[model samples]
Target: MQSQILPSRAALVDRIALQFEYGQNLIVLLGTSGLGKSYLLETFITDKYNDFNKAFVQVGAQMTDVQLMTQLLEQSFNAPLIDHNLSLSQNYYQLAKQQQCGACLWVIDGGRHLSEELIAELELLSKSAPNVLYIMIASQSKLPFKEVVNIHLEPLNLVESKQLMGWYFT
Candidate 1:
């Protein structure tokens, strides 16, 4: 796992770990493309945490809010359904409520692709739910959601970059 660490991400990961350890519920990791934000997120969740019901959503440029919600619901519930009548936002909200009995962590990657409306819907869902931790990755800092803790991931420093190369390539 050390090999997987990148210099640009070590300090951010340390900060995130500290926040998580302190029970900070929502964190938004902001970075540009190809900066290893997603990789760092994966490493954090896989290596540092357990007992969290995890849902990972990959946002596509062509995806609709409904489609995104449907995908999120499917991942969270491990269910397959073909209900065109039910709006995806409604379904997602309901599912979040149901999942809130336990600790639930949702990782939304490429969130910049989501429409403002869908982002707002997600924000509402997270805000209304008591035990939901939403971690979003985006290229920039602007998010349609509110009350989110933003962590900006800048490019790695020289030492950190070398460390990351060593961790991932060794």
Candidate 2:
């Protein structure tokens, strides 16, 4: 299937792009389960990847803070491991500074399962890498950080619903 979001959703995409361009680093995608939240975020990333280095990781319920940071570092910077002595915020800053790659977009899907400590680390990472856009997909607004840019996705309307069905049936 084509990784395209509906034109009706263009406003949301535009808003995200505008805010990210204007220095909004942490973006939270909130919606009820099965509301196409992941689809929307994926389409946005696919559409915008040409402009930024992109990485994505789906967090599991049992993942530890160190594992989360390791995954992020590997996915975003292709690094094997983060320096244990450095704080998460420091690692993020060091990675951003060392990587010659342009701005990065890090998508953490299934964020609802992350522990409070991991989320807090994410907040610190955002501050350290101002140019890196961190988007978290969660079922609710439970992020520890208050300065996040929240995007609430609504379910598809009738017209869009019919179109999606047609795409599958035709």
Judging by TM-score against the true structure, name the best candidate.
2
lDDT of 1 by residue, 13-132 (tens): 778768755656567777777777788767765765567666777777887777776666666564545355666546655555555435656777887787777666666666565555
78-120 per-residue lDDT for model 2 (tens digits):
5545896776667777877776655677788887877776677
lDDT of 1 at 43: 72
Instruction: State in Å the error of residue 113, model 1.
Output: 0.5
Q: Which ten contiguous residues of candidate 2 have the minimum total lDDT?
A: 132-141
Q: Sum up the clashes in candidate 2.
A: 0
Off by over 4 Å in 1: 1-3, 17-24, 78-89, 96-101, 167-170
For residue 110, model 2's alpha carbon misses the true position, in angstroms, by: 0.9
Per-prediction TM-score to the true structure, in the order listed: 0.76, 0.84
